[model samples]
Target: MNLFTKYLHSVTLSLSKGIQKIACLLLLSIPLFTQAEDGYKLWLRYDKITDKAQQSYYAPRLKTVYADLSDPSVKVAADELQLAVKSLLGFTPVVKAAGTGSQGLTLTIDPKTEGINEEGFSVSTTPKGIHIKARSGAGVLYGVFNLLKNIQTGADPNVTSSPEIQRRLLNHWDNHNGTIERGYAGMSLWKWYELPERIDPRYIDYARANASIGINGTVLNNVNASARFLTHEYLGKVKALADAFRPYGIRVYLSVNFAAPRILGKLKDADPLNPEVQKWWADKTKEIYDLIPDFGGYLVKANSEGEPGPMDYGRTHADGANMLAAAVKPYNGIIMWRAFVYAPDPKGDRFKAAYEEFKPFDGKFADNVILQVKNGPIDFMPREPVSPLFSAMEKTPVSLEFQVTQEYLGWATHWVYLAPMFEEVLKTDTHVKGSGSTLSGILKGDTFGYKMTAMAGVANTGSDRNWTGHPMTQANWYTLGRLAWDTRLTSESIADEWIRQTLTRNNAAVETIRKSMMKTREIYVNYTSPFGLHHVMGEGHHFGPEPWLDKAARPDWTAVYYHRVDSTGIGFNRTATGSNALAQYPGGLVEVYQDEATCPEPFLLWFHHVRWDRPMKSGLSFWNDFVKHFYEGARQVQDLQAEWQSVKAQVPPEIFNNVEARLQTQYKEAVWWRDACVLYFQTHSKMPVPAPYKAPERTLEEVKKLVDIYHIR
Candidate 1:
């Protein structure tokens, strides 16, 4: 070859090598861009603060951390602060054992401390540094989280707080085989197959997230429990999880099958009165406590949905609860007996079933037994009067059980922020004692002077990369923990805090997201169950619309039973002439609910049936207003999409894209709900689509077929 040709070949090889190096450098930098917004960290994301002024303020305050590392939880707290400081303030704090110095942050557990309970903590800024004092190690851990949260949100750190309820827990409806009942995010966070021998690091992250939100206990199995979970095999798996979570100040609880003695112990009848059954339970409780000394307790769903209870043996619920209470009382564990019992009586009002069954045995419950009542009378409807039992059960400790998982609120597909619903239910005046007797006060054991109090949220978390399926749904889990810790907090304040921590801290972006989140629940209710229409979704999965679901396994399970849509009008009449369910409420609510004129419009159809021609307060005919809500809800979802689009530049690309896709699906579903409900209910009312609003593009038959496809599984 010629010399000039050789020179050209060498030049080409050098250029190719340079281009490869550039490509490799770019590939290496991809993580730097993606890691900040992948959402795997949840709201606990401690990415470095962008504002230099805020970083300067926090760095000096947390220069050195000193805590008594004797307790495992306290050591975790110390480690957590150091890690958070390094991430948020760009410097690792010098963490040291206690008694080293009082010049920096000092965390102490002092039983003699005033104005704080066992799990409460007080943080105050001093001349030397910040000092945190709590009655126990758990409190120190909570205080550390509280301080970090303040720094993250750019708030003053001086605060004293305690969980108003004794036990704040998340009940997982997760089965033994890794499938969660009504869970939409993914299969389940607990890898049952890999457990006991191989502990998943995700378990620690779950514990950290729960502890950060002040959730202290978790029911690790489904309420529709399998007796296999009670076996020694599963107990060993639970112990491994308990060991991982203990350092985070989280205790593990189990949801037991009431018929465990019959299924697992090979007993006959499994009667609460039977000595063999009693002995079996006592031994099981002792065995569980032996493996997990800090085992919280048992959550039982008995005599509900065909589950076994003492009633199967001709005994009352109190008889069943007291038996289990006796077994756990020695270990300071409590029994949370669910009051979700109902029978398939075509002639009976399902709303009155729970109140009838549980009210008579209010004071009969054992001291350690807390009757767990759902927030609504009928299984977590979009909206309902707070359960009447919340007013009637004055003697028994009643813990409010809220569904954080959106089983009835469109599951993971629809974006519904539930804190508002929770706030509304909690603030409602039960008026059992007097006018000021709110459900919040009742759960706090304040009005009734009960010995113990607790609150449980049916967990929404799963194995999804973002924890909850929709990016925004994480706020619901956050809301549950915050409200369970202190019900008095306004939903708006909690949303603000969550937005600042989880999303971008830009003021404009925060407001836009907040407005959309705050309106989400109402928007969902409007589209799906406006004017108190409920249980009208597709059966089984509870997705889309099924206003024409007149036939089901039972009459009460069908939509026709609740809506009562006949040729004359719509809505179930629960007044004196109807079911008289209003009589179960306090006298004040009974008087108001009985009168259509005085009953709130939101609950209008829930208690009374009115004619289609009747005029509403909005001056539109009943049918028109109802139809208007459906259309308005669909339009609002479009608005939500627009609002989300407006904040695209401010949000991280991956999170922004993830939420954008969900919002698009939500808009389409909202339209589906609108078209389906309007078309089907229009057939009964025999009315037009109303003026200025176009009729659904599809026929009723077409909409029904779509719902049929959705329920094919």
Candidate 2:
């Protein structure tokens, strides 16, 4: 009741409130000190929005989520929405059972939605709230991710999406020992030593990222498969991964060693026609299905690079594929038979081998068998015409196999946006059926009628903190997934969307990054292997430059076998006078490619062996033009450095610095490629270094030594 007592009570309460406010501020500041952009989040960074108006708009609309948890995928969709809303809008959304007339986002499986495929979804803004509807749980997961993506990029949510191909998968060339075959991004993501029990949280994130872009399947092992993956022990490990990925709708597939019956089962011979061998595979398939019921099936790389196959037993590819297809067919599974076969003949053209082998058996493969052909006739070269097999196999359902690992694109050091390269191959006119017979059209079953369709990318992911070794290479993985979902997406638009979600959202920064990415692949090709000049990479590792490699296990594996450079001219002669590889294509393209004058300049060298002094359409001599590309490619990388430097202030310091360091490495490597290729090739051409470009400071011997130091054969 006294004035002094009342004043003391008021002071005590005021001090307590002030102390509580200070403690809360300290707790909030802890994240600022602890959190840093390390690229581990990838493009799904759901950090709180800094933009006040956008945050306000999203916060209220995403206050609640109505989803049916009975379906595991719908529960996953709900969980993702809650996490994203909490991170992006600073509050977790209350989740309710589906069919509730609540003013919140709705996740429902509406099979009646028109034009929506089994794995496709539609998102629309309703009067009550945003509605995401799909025919399946897989589609609901995809729709939820797309809805979140729209919120981040300020995109319209009223959209429907269906994958262009039925099977969009990532082929991981991971060995049982955790090493990736051509992987530059650290070690493999699968910790084989610890799997089957201790599942890495990264596996879940991996599935989430793939699901966001609509990748429905994954081949977990390398094409040069170890028979161990099929063993009961490894199947448990694979089942663990499959379980982690199942909620995201990603089914796990295996690349089986064809000699598993002999190697793993201790059979006398792994003959496809043998009853014992067939029964062995059937038992294995049943065992696998028992462990993982949704197993996607088998991806076989048989009779290539000394791998065992039906050919080993005097049988055909169809026999090998059909034998395995029969086992999986009982479970409605399919087989992806790789068409990357090459003969060991010293004098044969590697380009003609696949067509020669598979063309005859085009219609002989089992109905469940799909021929997985590389984008180019040769391996995943920097530039080559679309594979003849795409047009050659009319009766077989062919799937386009693309390598997103950047084995030839300077590994992880150099920046090369592969969307343009993928778009280029997909858009190439195959001329099989008509003018509009594109490679994409064929894979979509538009050009060739097929019961199934698929497109696969060799994954570039690894255990690195960034997932991909180089930050920019992550975009390639993103691009492959996006293009697989819808081949019609432009490379530019995909780059824009990725930049906004992953990097700085500033319009200027996005434009600069986009422009840099657009020119990245061309610059890489120019420096490494310009104008359809394929292979020529270091022998075993396929890194750096080795245009003069003449010695290898097989002649076809040698760089000299491909470039065929001599004192008089350069390039392979694939026309009628040479290997006659041009005949493999349709008549319309064959006529154009047979003659050097009519051939597209990019592919001129691929089809013709032009004289050193041949005049080019650029008004420069062939040798001079070739030299110009190498020099200009290196120069463009310098420009990329300058462009990146200008945007340093706009991007996060961690990401900006990471990319800036790589750009520096890229420039040095570009110069190394330019100097090495030009100096070595000049020996055969006997041409002077053209004007406006200085001769390389290092001699050919010095560059050779550099290759030795890098341990590149």
RMSD in Å for model 2? 5.1
State the lDDT at 387 in candidate 1. Answer: 90
Candidate 1 lDDT (Cα, whole model)? 0.89
RMSD for all candidates, in order, please: 4.2, 5.1
Model 2 has a clash total of: 0
lDDT by residue (tens digit), candidate 2, 459-577? 99998899998998899999989999999999999999898888878889899999999999999989988778989988889888888889899898888898889999889999989
Q: Write the per-residue lDDT of candidate 1 for residues 1-713, one digit (tens) a residue.
A: 45654554555556678885775565445433224576778788886788887766666668888878888989999888878888887788887878536568988989999998999999998755888999999999999999988887888889999999989999999999999998989989999889899988788889888999999999999989999999999999999999999998888989999999999999987899999999999999999999999898899999888888889999999999999999998899989999999999999999999999999998999899999999999989999888999888888989999999999987887889999999999999877887888899999988889879989999999998888898889999999999988899998888888888888888899899998899999999999999899889777777778888888888888888899997778998999999999999999878768888878889989999978988899999999999999999999999999999999988878888888888888888899999999998888899998888999888889888886566543
Worst 10 residues of 2 by lDDT: 26-35
Give me candidate 1's TM-score against the actual structure.
Answer: 0.96
Candidate 2 lDDT score relative to the true structure: 0.90
